[model samples]
Target: MRRIAVLLPLLAIGVLAGCGGSSSSTAKPVVKVSGAFGQPPTIKIPAEKAGGSLTVKTLIHGTGPVLQRTDAFVGNYAIYIWSGTSHRLAQSSFTAHRPTLFAGQLLPGLETALIGQKMGSRVLAVIPPKDGFGTSGNPQAGVKPTDTLVFVVDMMKDFKANASATGTAESNGGKGLPTVTAVNGAAPTIKMPTSKPPATLVTRTLIKGSGPAVTKGQMVVAQYVGAIWSTGKVFDASWNRHQPFNFTIGATPTQVIAGWDKGLLGQTVGSRVMLVVPPADGYGKSGSPQAGIKGTDTLVFVVDVLGAFST
Candidate 1:
């Protein structure tokens, strides 16, 4: 067993009692695991389950860097629900098509379970409704409001953001798309596109990098600033938060705009690129007003590709 320098709240308090009025001592080893890492485990559930809090048990220990709560830790997971009798495997992220999940991206309970665990570690956890799909369980996954969820997760890698946006600074003519300028390693400021938005995608690599080129189906860790082409109003920026934003490019149930898929497909990591996305490739007819974009607004983005992970 490897030593864990950082421990989550669950590890310290152990199993909590709740759900029904029964005490947790009645549900020892709420989630039973009898399988090797990287493969589906034989999970067994107790007749009595926990509900008040989360129960996490480390199955395989890892002797690597301890992960932070907000780190974009790439992982694979399989989730199941305790259906009255047996544990029915619901969803599995253990395939080659697993996505890297972050804080605001996963269930609050799962985050608590993964935090403090080092990279390459595997753990099993039982989550109650309070920390899971609340009173109204996710009907899509056949999860009942009162169902207890179990997960087998494998923390794979810890990704780090790049420092300065490095790459070959190129020009896109004097008045074509948009103009981007950065100083002293600061975030690039854009002078929004003056001409009408192009019908096709307009991608310009402001900086050419020496790192690996981003490929389709790879998750990109990056810092970016987005704006509306109509008014040049900055919609969102990752640099302002001093944190990097990440998403799978060209992935199933795409997490980012189509502009990113087309613009960043062949770009190199560590390079800053600008994308001019028309309505067809953006939020489309139903624009994101919360993002300050109109139905017909053309979106612009200055993305700093920090890293790419696949597997």
Candidate 2:
């Protein structure tokens, strides 16, 4: 768990004055500004008064509105600190608790930017060190005395008003199995058993490497190939030509379908497993068109558990 300490002292205070208490008694501060990604610093300003362009270079697949605290939002995220050519710090989707930012639990800049964002909105906020960790920087963050941060946040869900229901789905019950039905070195076909205790048991110890076995709350990096079981139509695959998908097992909650969660449980690290995920555990009735999956689709996946990280 990466602890993002709240450093309010360094935050610039932008105050706004309004009319007398004849009608309204409170005075709200309003600040505004703008810029592009990777640009040099022109001046230091308070978060409430700060503003800028997102200038998205790559908008990964997402669904919904930009997340905002005012409107209520909750989800997992990945953060990375970047220096010229290297990443200073990085944290992937390792959240077990659906952090709630209702009032003031986040940085001023983040809170201001995230408020009003709709559900499923993925955003890339280019934050200067000033609006972020400030000059002294976050010692705990390993952020150097001088470093800018880039946060690639994926808003998986928003349950500002309703937390209990979403929270329950996020902490999936712990009991599932990895099923293998096909094999192809880098990408294999897999299936997740449906029976409440998973009646089917298929295992393949392909090219075993020494490491810890896959655990419940660990992060795993994997390459996979998925297709509809009935028609053998390819749906989604990371082995084609893209970065391997990374996820903290049981951390994403409903980010992945039930079938995927059940299929990946209890697999050893560095081993390839195939799974057959039924529609009930998959996308259900709302199949993804982009992936060519239908309501009654049965998914076949080949998962290569490249690595696992424990906290």
Q: Candidates' TM-scores? A: 0.69, 0.41
For candidate 2, which ten residues in a row score worst on lDDT? 163-172
lDDT of 2 by residue, 17-68 (tens): 1111111111222111223222211222233422222222223434576554
- Candidate 2 lDDT: 0.45
Question: How do the residues 50-138 of candidate 1 rate in per-residue lDDT, one tens digit apiece?
Answer: 44557787889988789875556566677778755556666665554654444234565666677789877888877777666667666
Error of 1 at 277 (Å): 2.9
Clashing pairs in 1: 167-207, 167-208, 168-207, 168-208
Worst 10 residues of 1 by lDDT: 1-10
Model 2 regions lying over 4 Å from their true place: 1-210
lDDT values for all models: 0.68, 0.45
